[model samples]
Target: MTGFDTFLVADWSAAQGVRRAGKDAIWIALAQDGAVKPARHFSTRLDAEAWIAETIRAEIAAGRRVMAAFDFPFGYPTGVVEIICGAADPLALWDWLAARITDDARGRNNRFAVAEEINALFPGEGPFWGKHNRDAYPGIPYGGRSRTAEVSEKRACDISAKASSSVWQLAFPPTVGGQALMGMPMLSRLRRIQGCAVWPFEAWQEAQAVLTEIWPGLIEPAVRASDDLRDRAQVEGLARALSRLPLAELERMMDIDAPEEGWILGAGHGERLTDLARPNSLRPPPLRNDCFALPAGVDWTPVDTALALLRERLHPVTGTTKSGLFEAEGRILAEDVIARRANPPHPNTAVDGYGFAAASVGEGDAVLPLVQGRAAAGAPFEGPVPRGSALRVLTGADLPAGVDTVVLDEDCSVGDGRVAFRGGVKPGANTRKAGEDAGEGDRVLSAGRKLTAPDLALAAAVGHGTLPIREKLRVAVLSTGDELTEPGDVPGAGGIFDANRPMLLSTLARWGHVPVDLGRIPDDRSAVAAAFDRAGRDADVLLTSGGASAGDEDHVSALLREAGAMQEWRIALKPGRPLALGLWNDIPVFGLPGNPVAAFVCTLIFARPALTVLAGGNWAEPQGFEIPAAFEKRKKPGRREYLRARMRDGCAEVFPSEGSGRVSSLSWGEGLVEIEDGERHIRPGDPVRFIPYGSFGL
Candidate 1:
């Protein structure tokens, strides 16, 4: 009875700019049982919405069960509920944001400006950071700390393969913020459809068209990440993947307890998320107006959304100082690299050769007479080239006035400085002109640019003796677990060394942040709180591993809830399941999973981007490479998954197991073989997606 007769996938777009077919426009795909279809494109998002509406109605009328999965977030991070809707209900927040953001049926919209407007409320550069036509909002940094630090990112059932995007990220391609902003309105309409139900928020019904969110990367992570591939490939591929799903598996993914946070259809939490009998109460989820996120067990925030949300409260520090050119390299510039002088300083020869006026040689002449004094580099000829004469000019030498060209030595033979050359020489050949590379007073490099070798060279060439730069950030790490011991010390029976603390410290150091170790906790509540206080006071960011989840042994989390607010975000990520973001005495704390693999995944997927932003670096996703599979796998739908894998002989070979606790699997792989949430039956030779660990700097 839970099986669906039809499966449809929508590859959504939130472009507020020009739409082109087979590219920026929306595409949809459909499948049923053994029948699957290629993707169909629409000229406008509205056209696609209209088509979906028609399909839903037709399916309902025909007495067939239809399940539709769209590629936009159905929910945002926690606390955003209050900021967005002024309500605790996640669906209400969706409706609110959907109403404020406008997308015409024709695809023309103000999505970019709207992103700027949303960012205005956040504390830093943005939760949203890319755009094509729009300039960034003034005073808003190009890179800064996450605004939505209130929510724990990894708690949402998101796999690390495809991170979520904020609702405010309306400008960039691949970022689904704009799509969610614009798409939600249409989704609200569908919710009101005669026979429709949005999962988790709306209880499922057999006759209703069950609508859910889908991660396009779930089935084709690397393919979707490929620049050469069109998004329709994702739609068509995922639609086919869904159609191939076993009926039992399909039902399991659909049945989850996601009321405040909408669930992804193929998150693969199916068996665990299956409908469970529980007591119903009038009590509702808590809403936090404080700095920390409010806890809600079931519907956790997606990682991308949480990151954007986290960035909302934090801002890039405005600590700037002047540094000499030698010291400026590898630093973030605080002021524009203004040019004091033009490059080259004066017109000079572009190559080593003889310089002469083209008119000096007759149209029929093959050779020219000699001239006085050779114009070698650094030895300019103050006088003009005499009529009917040539001068030997070395490369980088100033071209004599009235000389319009330079003939290479290889092209001519000089006897006593007199040049004999080819039949005809080109005008202005191999010459350098005054201010050719840059003009005086030109802003060679803009402010906020991280000075690299090329950037330093550019600034130095323009006579910049010193540059202004921002200070580096200070980061601290804490590990909390009863079973953890220091690696240097022998562990007691049944205890393991605390791997996450040192690992986080090392990761922070690699990213140019000052790392301060807060040491480890032995699952004691009071000790955990005191350690948190110390970390907050000593570092710009306080990070903790283990005790992030609400287990009996999660003493740190229990203390966090008592001292400050703690939100357990159930990110749809494999290897990691929960992320905690909290504030103790106004200091932001990042809580990660206890498992070394999960902690590392969360740090890569959430913390890395956040740290970069805090250090005035723009938010970016870790890109993946599309490769072939060397092994087969069978998995359920509901949670995104990551498998340690190595590229071998042109194929991606996955590790034998998918457990997060297996640190050896991580060490054994060069990268990860990603399996997007949902039922999947992968086989050898299939085009599988691989994300290299090196891409994340692991």
Candidate 2:
């Protein structure tokens, strides 16, 4: 028998809360009849599972056999299944997880709690490890074990796939424990769909829709293309490759399946699969480890120098995905969108009046006979408007073959079977030439551009229905301080409501980033450490507001220096002098000042443009204009300063207070008036740089 007619590959995620198309989120790519379709994204497992089931049924209804593959492992190590379910069956283990895992529609789930419960069933820390909150899950361990007398860390297939992380390792890169825990339930639901059969466990030829586990990493080298999202490329590449494999080869790869612990398809046949697939060269490069590293002995950096370093070091850390034109607004382009056809598509009239060869009009006022029929918009006159004869045309009408010039209706007199116009109505006047706006194959939108509504309109006019755009960067926001409490919660005396996290999160959303809330972390060493680990796993970057300074309670910077790569930047800027740049487990972290106003300014001045570059766009320079200052003050030479200000009658007005501690100043002003470095006595009429809030994409 031949192989299945369709292949569907799903990259699963364990992230909580609904998410957009982003790195580490679920992506489903399909290949039908040897053609790979654009991958689809799902924010929650319920949605992904529902879509997968419907797609399988539709394909089967169409009489095409389907093969569905999931990236997570189908089962745990051999003995663990028997210990958890009292049976040597992977399907039984799926049922156990499905029954206990409380995954809501929003993707909030009790997977960690379930892991802890499962650990209680076994002695000396059960198989699952690496919970985000170690204190909350005492039953679960924080690290993996080599082996136990009864259980093994890895199954036999992991060695075949050369996978680095075991099923027991969670919370770290390359780990499969969380994926399997969160995914198995969805897999179980998919297996119950009509005409579905589990691979290796069921007869393949007899099943109309086969569901199996896949390891996209097995062919990672072949799909590691530049400028594309890794998850997107992997699914697209693997689906296309696997759908081409012969049934005999597929069966041979499945020859040594552990029925209790399901085998990854093509686990032992990596060379064969890799050879059949061509590498995809369309993905963004993974973020480099040294992107944030600075040369030794560099300290007390200037604002301009710090920004320059960020621009030089940063690259697009997000992946690319195809979005329909309407959905592409605010998204950065992944690749240049070329025009499929020219704008106007044909020589057309720009005004409603006379159209005739410019040669017929002699450089003087003239009159000409009219053509038999008028061309208005979509309608065109039949024959060429014989050289000397004028054709009456309306706006947007295609010009007759012999016509080259037109006169505006208001500038001409048309009646009595003739049209007359004033002199100096130059050749090609009021006419739109073919391809005037954009020609076929021309780059209408360049890569790294953030798409706007006008851009969408232009793309649609040029025949582009969809655009390739970078996935939104997931930025985790955290706040640290013992004296702060959530806004809605009551604080007895010293506690104040946390503002930085919410403000940062809102700004991130406005700037087209997916904001991940890591919640508040008190000034505790271990708590900060746990939050950092979680941030690494959950977000592309972490933005922390407090505990960035070197005070004893400044655990954020201290831990980063101790455990990960860090660069303490004593930036030469007033109100926001202390800044922390670091990498926590390879994820970039930006630590801003504790003062609300300073954090707001730093995020705009530093993080704003840096994030734009990281999100696959050009280095963003917020638009600023020079306007006369309404207030005067003396300046210092050592650092640049920004005063919360607003425009009043076309002049800049500084706020009453310049203190970074004045949280009210942020809301009191419309924008910031920038004071350049160097001592200066500002006058009321002095030209000052004014940056509106809108310029920062706020």
RMSD of each: 25.0, 19.1
Using Cα atoms with residue i matched to residue i, what is each candidate's TM-score against the true structure?
A: 0.55, 0.62
Best-fitting candidate, scored by TM-score: 2
Encode model 2's per-residue lDDT on 97-120: one tens digit a residue.
999888889999898889878887
Q: List the residue pairs that clash in candidate 2.
A: 226-283, 227-283, 227-284, 228-282, 228-283, 228-284
Whole-model lDDT, candidate 1?
A: 0.70
Off by over 4 Å in 2: 1-283, 363-365, 411-416, 420-424
Error of 2 at 310 (Å): 0.6
Candidate 1 residue-wise lDDT, 1-698, digit = tens: 34577888898887655467667678888876536676787777778888999999998898888988898888766565665456778777656666676766566776666666766665545465555534555533343243443444332656433455444454445566668777887888887889798886876756569888887655543243335346776776666656645443455556677666676776753211111101111221222336445344537555555666656644554345445577566666666777899987887888888888877676564677777778877788879887778888898888878788888889888786567887667777888778788889998987656678998888888888767665555577888877889989989999898877777887777766667667777888878877776555445567888888788988766776776577667787788877877766555567888889998888887888776656555554688988889998888877777888999899999889887878888679888777876689998888888999877756
Which 10 successive residues of model 2 have the least lDDT summed? 272-281
Model 1 stretches astray by more than 4 angstroms: 1-298, 307-314, 362-365, 433-437, 440-450
Q: By TM-score, how accurate is candidate 1?
A: 0.55
